[model samples]
Target: MTDTTRPQDPDSRCGFVAIVGRPNVGKSTLMNHILGQKLSITSRKPQTTRHQVLGIKTIGPVQAVYVDTPGMHEEEPRAINRYMNKAATSALKGVDVVVFVLDQLAWTTADELVLEKLSSLKCPVILAINKVDKIEKRETLLPHLDMLSRKRDFAEMIPVSALRQTNLLPLEECVGRFLPQSVHFYPDDQITDRSERFMASEMVREKITRQLGAELPYSVAVEIEEFKHDGKTLHVSAVILVEREGQKKIIIGDKGDRLRSIGQDARIDMERMFDNKVMLRLWVKVKRGWADSERALKSLGMNDF
Candidate 1:
């Protein structure tokens, strides 16, 4: 279904676009790059994104609502993975365009699996060959694109460097053509479809993933208990829930050093994001087996799982 909320003036157009692919193809990075802001978190690790994040980008006559979805991969075959995959699949429904982002370094069976799904999509599909900066020669990139182009029918194929902000405007222009004329879906100044609390939790999670690394990143959740603004400063308090006492100890660190570092990093980013000083207090709590517990997962916004 086309989004008819945008103004119908000759110069007005708005629509939704879904960026889908296997994990770590720079979907979140592309969203942030297009919006010219950090609307979503980025991590080198796979499956860093767990939700369908909306990033708004307005250029001339078009406002593109870009949905950054979780990476699709085969896992334990449980409810969580099912939900995550469903979130990505749901994004394909009723959209103006679909950008199938791909990593240039390597193509795997899993990549084919994602493309196979895209081949069945009804909307126009654009193959965005991300990480073009990693490719040394332009000629070398053609073969990779050709291989995938032959596998499915893509509306348009374009190479882009989402991290380096290269060759993106053309892709944006290409996407804008698919948007229907309508009223603006959001204010021109709006940038994302996430709440401050949600963004704050995501920032904390990004820091945790960066410092603590993989094994512990997936086992943690951040809950914002207090967020208050007093004109002078933004005071925030959050709980980092872990699945075990050992995980809690690891997060808290020796004499709370680790937790302190994480808090400091998150606070700095939060301050920069909000354009004000932030007082952040972090505490670690244990909710053993929360990831596996359906009730607990639902409370943590993992209900899709």
Candidate 2:
């Protein structure tokens, strides 16, 4: 009989790393770039992410399980907003390292709120100065970097452009140093903890968010009515929930053109993600005050975090 024993590497490292910051600060973009895939949904709108997304990257013997959290905001006027805040802060617990993302040289009251949470964490925190490509003068960043250093004793600070994929290797190296040595927690080939169904809903929601822009508020939510695979084609039916009839009409657009465009764009992404032909159907429904009701949020699966 042949022996089938697998030996563990002594140098292998694995741990959770939380990516956190104020809304629209490129936290999702940073993790997507680092993992070399789009595991988290992103938009220009603040608080685009409402749950905790895990993007796992395994390189050689080192595995970094990144928790891509919803951006922390100062306001929690609605139940959904409070849920997002809970999701973001929960990612910090038991994390081996924390990557605090900041936009360029700007700091606001929202960033101050995130800083207050970091003050109590015992783990290492690394400051990632994102959108550095927007800075016209390189010399101007030194003074800003010095000012940031005074705010907290970060484990490491590196300037990076998440969109341009610049200087990210150094950032990854810095995060890897703080991870503890242990056996790999997940398979190397697996990229995310989210299921295909969850990703499908996110793809649909991303299209809606991008299409509506400022015309629509955060009251929009997507629920997958049907997800079935037949032959070589994947069929998906998603219902878009809104707080008011006017919001539904806006999403439907004149002659349903906007809804068609959103569905077409979302199908393209679903095809690429699943590597199969996708047939998508969308419907708009009015669900008033869903954002403010905790019961409604739980029914929509928004309270899972």
Candidate 3:
């Protein structure tokens, strides 16, 4: 006899929720916090996310598949930037709910771009004012909240701090209410749709971005050349692609100290995520004009959207 019990509750709720915003608005952080794990790469740098990362959360009868998309920026100086914008815009389509994340009391042309995109969305749009923890005056928020309501007829407006884990329960509840009635799309144990190899590359890229900060622009990308397992350890070899020899030198640092530091940080993260010891190898190579070339971008998995 085959014992396959029910996959989910008969009356469970499940749907896709796209999290959209401008660059550096904490969209990835919010999705990571909501899932209680880091499914998307995040850094202080703008445009840190260049693809649509799916983070799935299942609790009881509710499952929310959150799409953490690239930040929408108006400037498409290169083919990669245009690809990022396209990925973010595509996340809005066929979604059951949309969470428009915004920085606390700060609005820019980029935010306006996101707002303009949301103007025609059919799903429920929830305005989540993030970074409220940074706000000193609580009373000032009321006026800002009042002003935000005029922007659109948002389904719900919640003040939250994705970094501090504040008011997230309310936000989850609000999101849950909008999910349609359906069986879960993914297994409850599954946290993300991406493979371990993809996550390894993202970890390496994140470490580079965090370590170098503004020193390295969007000219860097990571590709996993090898992923294998032996005994109890997982071995990963990645190549860091840069646009110029000078950029390669910057990543390698003096006497390769910077590269070693980046490797260590990334290995630690991989260990935690994989729950196994990691043997990570990194190499920096100059891949000139890869970002500006659409074919190169597609080869690097940046055009999957």
Candidate 4:
């Protein structure tokens, strides 16, 4: 005879879930879709996510802390690349569930690297093949799904279009089932684990990603030196850090046109995010070879390495 017992009460379910994948796999987009807010930045550029951002979701009696990590990649051996890889790997520790996001259209060598890592995790994993909308037919997905499933022991395999908000609820339900029953870790009203300054910096960097081409996006980082709020207005000052003078020239653009455009877009988003009027000041600074410097990487909240 088989003994079966019901799981714990719904009121006790709470835990952390990490989303891991290669760049442009729609991890951040899916996290925002689930939380129904833009807590993390997203862009078309590869490696758009540079840090591990936590977005919280509360439904009925469960609170799931979802971490969106930087895209895993094999790049030049540098401090930043090491930091990114470290940050992505660190999310697996103590996680209740792992959501391995993949681009259904383009599953390349980098995706294979992420898949190899996911195969070794002991916890429950859900293979989320995102961007299904981009694919022409459903049958085309089978080979990739079969290939991945055979290579790993994922608890469930689900397809989703993070950009179109399709199949996300089903994916959430799958992840929810894996979380252990426990007391809520955060209040229901809270949506994210990052601070306003951190989010603002990310917003600025995202704007850079959208406005600038691919070559310059990954080399850029934004630092918020000051953020002050009065009743009616918020004042913000940020510095866009680049790795070299050529990148700085490109970021500032001809006669500051590019910088102004980036600042305008970022300011608009910040105002919407903060829900108040804002006075934003943006400056571009060149820090040659900073991406490879441990000291510089540590200063950017990437001290974990």
Best-fitting candidate, measured by lDDT?
3
TM-score: which is higher, 2 or 4?
2
**Model 3, C-alpha of 18: deviation from truth (Å):** 0.5
**Which portions of model 3 miss their true places by more than 4 Å?**
1-10
TM-score of each: 0.93, 0.97, 0.97, 0.93
Global CA lDDT of candidate 4, please? 0.86
Give lDDT: candidate 4, residue 205.
Answer: 88
Q: Model 3 clash tally? A: 0
Report the C-alpha displacement of residue 268, candidate 3, in angstroms.
0.3
Off by over 4 Å in 4: 1-10, 215-217
> Local distance difference test, per candidate?
0.85, 0.92, 0.93, 0.86
lDDT of 3 by residue, 194-218 (tens): 9999999999999999999889889
Candidate 4, residues 1-305: lDDT per residue as tens digits? Answer: 22122245545688899999988889999999999999879988877887888898988767789999989997747888888888898888889999999888576899888887776677898989898998998888988788877767789999999999999999999988888888777776788878999989998988889888565746788889999998889999999999888898898989999999999999999999999898999998988877889898888777742
Worst 10 residues of 2 by lDDT: 1-10
